[model samples]
Each structure stands twice: as structure tokens, then as C-alpha cells.
Target: QQQVKQSPQSLIVQKGGISIINCAYENTAFDYFPWYQQFPGKGPALLIAIRPDVSEKKEGRFTISFNKSAKQFSLHIMDSQPGDSATYFCAATGNQGGKLIFGQGTELSVKP
Candidate 1:
């Protein structure tokens, strides 16, 4: 109930395409859901997030869709690009200051 598992350890897409990644958790106690994008040698930054109360959230070209009942969520990158190629991680925080749990990293490569 405290782990987030991500798929497709790596992905490749052409520029201007859509990149989709999925993650699921077993814990229902998780309240704060966040997706973080990280570039090489940089710390993960919060990209977009949603709570159990919300079904979906979007920010610019990034969108996070959450499924409370199924204990799952996903990240969709619109207009995939070479510059967008990087590692993305799905994370969760149960309460304030609760250590964020991260899914196995995903390497996304958008070919130019």
C-alpha cells in the first residue's frame, strides 16, 4: 500500500507525438499524488499533481489522470519532443513530510 510501480522502464516516441506512462499503487491511504520530471543530473521537480478528491489535473503540456477506486494514475505528455526526453517518476505522499515514494524510473526518448 505504499509503493508505486511504473512500467516500460524506457520509452521512445517521435517528436510531436504523445507519450503515455502508467503507474499503480496498492495503498489507499495515499492522499497526495504527484508526478515529477527529472532531467539528467538534476533533481526531480514537481510537474503536476492531484489528490484523491480530483479525477484529473493538467498543466501546460503535462496531464495527470488519477483513478481513486483502482488505485492507479498516469502521465500524458502532449506533443512529445526531443527536449522532453528525460526520466519521469510517479510519486506519492501520504501526509505532510511523509517521505515521497517513487516508482522505478522511466527513460523517455523523443526522437527528433
Candidate 2:
């Protein structure tokens, strides 16, 4: 079965702190990993993405650290803010018709 397991169903971070979310995958067919951020009453948006070729990718305060050998990846939010309070999801998809598998999801709350 193809699936991604995510940790910390809910997280609480202080403003200006770092928020970390972890995920692991079971499908080797997956070649692409993407993180999505969803605000209340809004659909999820692509926050960042990574491939097996890279160990890490950073865009502004959002960074994705990947471990291909271990089949794991993580998202780090630097300088966490209340505005960042949203549900985060880790997903994976491969060349097999581009079927995407999503993790359980993590609801992150940034407290001021």
C-alpha cells in the first residue's frame, strides 16, 4: 500500500520559534514529496516540495529536509508566527499516473 505517516497530530509553537513536522513514507514508487499548508476555510496550498535528488530545500522561512535512504522527510518553519497557524500536510506522488498520497495531517498553532 502507498501511504505517508505524519507525526504530531497537533503542534503548538511560540511566536518567533521554530515549528517542525515529521513524515515517513512506505511507498518506494514515490519520487516527489510536497508539503501543503491549509488555512481555515481554504483549500491546501503547496508550501514547498522536494525530490530524492536533494537533501534539503529552503524558501524563505520554510525549509524541507529530506532523507531518501530512510524514506523520510521533514518541514521546518523558522520564526513561527501566529499568522502561520494552519493545518499542514505531507504528500507524495510518483510517475505512476501521478497518484498522490497524503499524510494524516498536522494542525499547527502558533501562539503569540
Candidate 3:
């Protein structure tokens, strides 16, 4: 299996603090990278993403920082909230195969 490595299996952040999760892949063919947020008993949904050509993308308090050469990316949540607690997954997809490769999920907790 093409593996995407993730760090800090779990993370704890205080409300209003920042939450960050990172992932790295070795596949050079992967072009699309997206971060998904999954709440308990719910399916994961796209949170933020960036192409290899872009260095960063931000929406609201969420940001995706990409490094093409390093084949790595990260998700940053500014001013995290208790409601932001969820499982985050980093995924990569290539055009040729159309398979989405996911990193080990990161569990984030925002303490009130």
C-alpha cells in the first residue's frame, strides 16, 4: 500500500488555541491533496485542500500548507474551538489512477 505518514497520532488543544496536523507521502504522482474532518458518527467531509503548485490555502480559521518538493502537507486550525474536535485525515489523489490515498487519521481535541 502506498503509505501516507501522519504525526502525533492524537493532539490536544485548548479552546482558542491552534491545532495542527501533518502528513507526508512519497508518491510523486499524487496531485490533489485534501484534508477531511470527521465528527463522531458522521462521515468525513472536505475541510481544506491545496494543489502541488500552491504553497498554501486558507479558509476561515483553517489553513492547508503544502510543500510539493517535500511531498508533505499540514492542516492548521487557528482559534480552535471545542466544536472543532474531530478526526482529521489527509488524502492524496492522482489523475492517472484516481485512487485516494489517506494518511493515518489524527484525532484532535479542543478543551474548553
Candidate 4:
């Protein structure tokens, strides 16, 4: 199972509020979990990532939580701002050396 399931296809949050997005994977071989953020008309950029060894990782206002046992991971954005509005995607890759499997994107709209 190489699929990554994401939830809350769309989300709206007020400025300074917290934004949460969740994802789950079925592949146990997956070792790398990465989250990407994309703006309109732009390519997705690496936001944050965590390995199965790490339970959680944070960068700036972005944080990624990993649960290897549950085959799940999530992204949390603290102090969400209108400028933070964008689409986010969670992806996983295994040691088999294939393309990363991506989850359905979540559209986030942060209101001021």
C-alpha cells in the first residue's frame, strides 16, 4: 500500500489561529515523509519533513508530527496569516526507489 490519505480538502482559519492538516499512509516501507506548500501559479516547495525516527519536527511556524506506528503524519501551522494561505501536500517515499507518493492536497485560506 503506497497511498497517502489526506483530509479536510479545504480549510478556513482566522489570522493568528492554528491550522491543522492530517495524512495517513499504508506503506510501511516509507521512510521519508515530507510536506509541500504551493502558492498560486508556483511549484510546490518543501515545507517540513520528518523521518520515522523523529516523533516531531518544527520549522518557524510550521511543524510536522510523525507517527510511525500508526502510519500517519500531520502538519500544523501556528499563527496562521493571510499570507500563509496556500495548498499543502503530504508525500512519502520508500527504499524501493520510486517516485514519491503524494496525498490529495489541502487548500488553506487564512482570513485576516
lDDT of each: 0.90, 0.95, 0.91, 0.93
Residue 3 accuracy (lDDT) in model 3: 83
lDDT of 2 by residue, 1-112 (tens): 5879999899999999999999999788899999999999999999999999999999999999999889999999999999999999999998778777999999999999
Give the alpha carbon lDDT tens digit for every residue of 49-93 in model 4: 888999999999999998888888999999999999999999999
Tens-digit lDDT track for model 3 on 8-94? 799999999999899999989888998999999999999988888889999999999998888889999999999999999999898
Off by over 4 Å in 1: none
TM-score of candidate 1 versus the correct structure, residues matched by position: 0.95
Please give the lDDT score for candidate 2.
0.95
Q: Estimate each model's TM-score.
A: 0.95, 0.97, 0.95, 0.96
Model 4 has an lDDT value of 0.93
Top candidate, metric TM-score: 2
RMSD of each: 1.0, 0.7, 1.2, 0.9
Better of 3 and 4 by TM-score: 4
lDDT comparing candidate 1 with the true structure: 0.90
Candidate 1 per-residue lDDT, tens place, 1-112, comes to 6789998799999999999999999988889888888999999988888899988888989989999988999999999989999999998888957789999979999999
The best candidate in terms of lDDT: 2
**Which residue pairs overlap in candidate 3's backbone?**
none
Model 3, CA-based lDDT: 0.91
TM-score computed on alpha carbons, candidate 3: 0.95
Order of candidate numbers by lDDT, starting with the best: 2, 4, 3, 1
